[model samples]
Target: MTTLPIYQLDAFTSHLFAGNPAAVVPLEQWLPDETMQLIALENNLSETAFFVPVENGDADFHIRWFTPTVEVPLCGHATLASAFTIFNQLGFAGDEIRLQSKSGILTARRDGEAIVLNFPVQPIVPGTASDAILAALSQEKPQEVFKVVSRDTDYVLVYESDKTVRDMKPDMSALGALADRGVIVTAPSDSDDCDMVSRYFLPALGINEDPVTGYMHCVVAPYWAGKTGKASLIGYQASARGGFIECTVEGERVHLKGRAVLYMKGEIYLP
Candidate 1:
């Protein structure tokens, strides 16, 4: 049997079950795409990150993220979790861990006890709301809708209040029928601790609701920053397994800071 080491980690939070769980697998070389997809299905986490060492280059590794149903272009919490594995478990010597991905070269470095990820900002633009989206979300009329034009299109629904975002009960089956990667719901935070609150839903990608989504914040940070006139702000994901993110928008980049904790370690035996 071919055995590979695997780690499950709770990302974006210091506690065990409060954040999104991702599986990390380090490989010496690339595996077949089908094989990786199978592994992701077996892992059945929000995301499974696979990485291989880069040969004498600017990046430390080349990484990819997979949901149970599909491969995604970018992911934030999994990227952070991958850096944690490299720094703490794999004994990476450098303070900065760079990853080459489909989106582009992504960087992560330490910020006190937290890890900050430097990701390209995904700008949002005005968009029309589809009836499918409205039927799927089944919430109060969104104040506005925006489009994230990335590898795949994701809809952003801006609500009037954080409570509206938190109280959402999306129709997963209806959401899965929409022709988009997912939907991001956000609103101004009523709390003093953060500027905005959000929840992510990607039923088509096999996640009904994602806890502590970092990729979604890459878009939310700048949108809220522009509205609030602050370069740095805090965000809270109001999932049952809640998580916090410290967001800073710089020029065209977004920095997301959060903590992670390892949940389990095991070996995957495949032939």
Candidate 2:
């Protein structure tokens, strides 16, 4: 039997169990896609990361990420978790780790005790949305709904109040039918703990709601930063199980600041 090491870490939070939990597996070679998917499903977290040594640099590596159900182009929390696993758990001596990923090359670095991730900034432009998406949410649409394609996200619906965003119960099937990717509903946060609050739903993508998502900020960070005219902001993910992220817009890149803690470390036995 061959055993592979697996490490679990919470990303976007300093302490264990506070932020999103992701499993990290450091592999010597790439496994078959089916095997990788099986590992992700068995881990049963939103995402699991697998990394192999990269060609050009000892301080660098190549990484891939998989959700339980599918492989996404980009994942934030998992990348952070993977970096933490590489540095603290694997005992790599480094201030930063750069990895090539499906989303393109990405970097995660140590900022004091916290890890700051630099990812591409994808913002929304104003456009019109089909009624399928509009009809899914129970709340009233923002007056600004008739706008741009917003890249892959549907709309940046700004609500009148936090109550409406918090209390909203989307018609999932309807939302799924309406969206090709999904919708992100945001509100100006009234919480003193955070600069903004929002929720993510991707009925079309198979996830109803994610606990703490770093990838969503690829769009959210830039959109809100432009609105506030601040390059740096803090975001709160408003699910019942809440998570927080510190966001900064750097030219064409977005910097997400947060802390990670290790949860579990073990192995996967493969025949």
Candidate 3:
């Protein structure tokens, strides 16, 4: 029997149940892919993150994230949750935590009570897609499309209005059939509240809609900052379950900082 430590945490918010909730499973050794997938499905959360120590790095580990159906290349909330668990509960004294993920080397630091993650910036390259692509979203066509070279291979769609960004009842099945990783529907903030806002609907990657997606900012923050000529911006993930992030776009890195609260801690007894 293998006893695993599992934690459920709300990332990007100081209060419980206010942010994106993720289940973090820290493992001494990597488990079989099938078993990990099953566990993730059983947990049935937006994401379940798994961690295993790296071979030579004393302070680093290899981490991966999964939805119920497929593994994801990058996941921000889960990464935040994983680091929070390590720093606050795992008895490790450190100001920064590093994890080598599929997307690349990622780092998180404690900033006061919040966690700031310096992740690779996935710049959005302007492009266009078919009208069917527009039809699938069930919303007005994006004024433009943003592409990236990162392994996430996502397309960011810029909508004309915030109401369209939110009200579009996308055909999940059709949008999910997209050829790329998925599409991100976004719009400029209508209110004077934040710099911009977004909602993720990745029906193709087995997620009909993601509640609070910090990962999409890898593209959104940089795109918006370039337009506004500001390196830093505030973003609100306008999902039904909303969340906020304070972000800054540096040369080739994106700094996404937010606070998280632990929601659950328990042992995983594998039989």
Candidate that scores best on lDDT: 1
- Per-residue lDDT tens digits for candidate 2, residues 1-271, read 9899999988888777677889999998999988998899888788899999877764388888887777777889999999888888888787889888876789998889888998987656676677667667854766555222334455567676766778888898888777766577777778787767777787765677777888877777777788789898889887766788999898989999888888889888999
Q: Which candidate is the best by TM-score?
A: 1
lDDT against the true structure, per candidate, is 0.91, 0.80, 0.84
Task: TM-score each candidate.
Answer: 0.97, 0.90, 0.93
Give the runs in model 2 whose Cα sits over 4 Å from its true position.
57-59, 146-155
User: Over the stretch 1-271, how does candidate 1's per-residue lDDT look in tens digits?
Assistant: 8999999999999989888999999999999999999999999999999999999987889999999989988999999999999999999988999999998999999888899999999988889778878877865789999999783478898999898888888888888878467889999999999999999888878888999888999989999999999999999999999999999999999999999999999999998
lDDT of 3 by residue, 1-271 (tens): 9788899998988897687889999998889999899889888888999998777863488899998888888899999999998889887687988889888899999999998998888866677777877888864667888766674357788887888886878777777776356778888888887888888877766777787777888779988998889899999888777888898999989999998899989988888
How good is model 2 by TM-score?
Answer: 0.90
Candidates ranked by lDDT:
1, 3, 2
What CA RMSD would candidate 1 show? 1.1
- State model 3's lDDT: 0.84
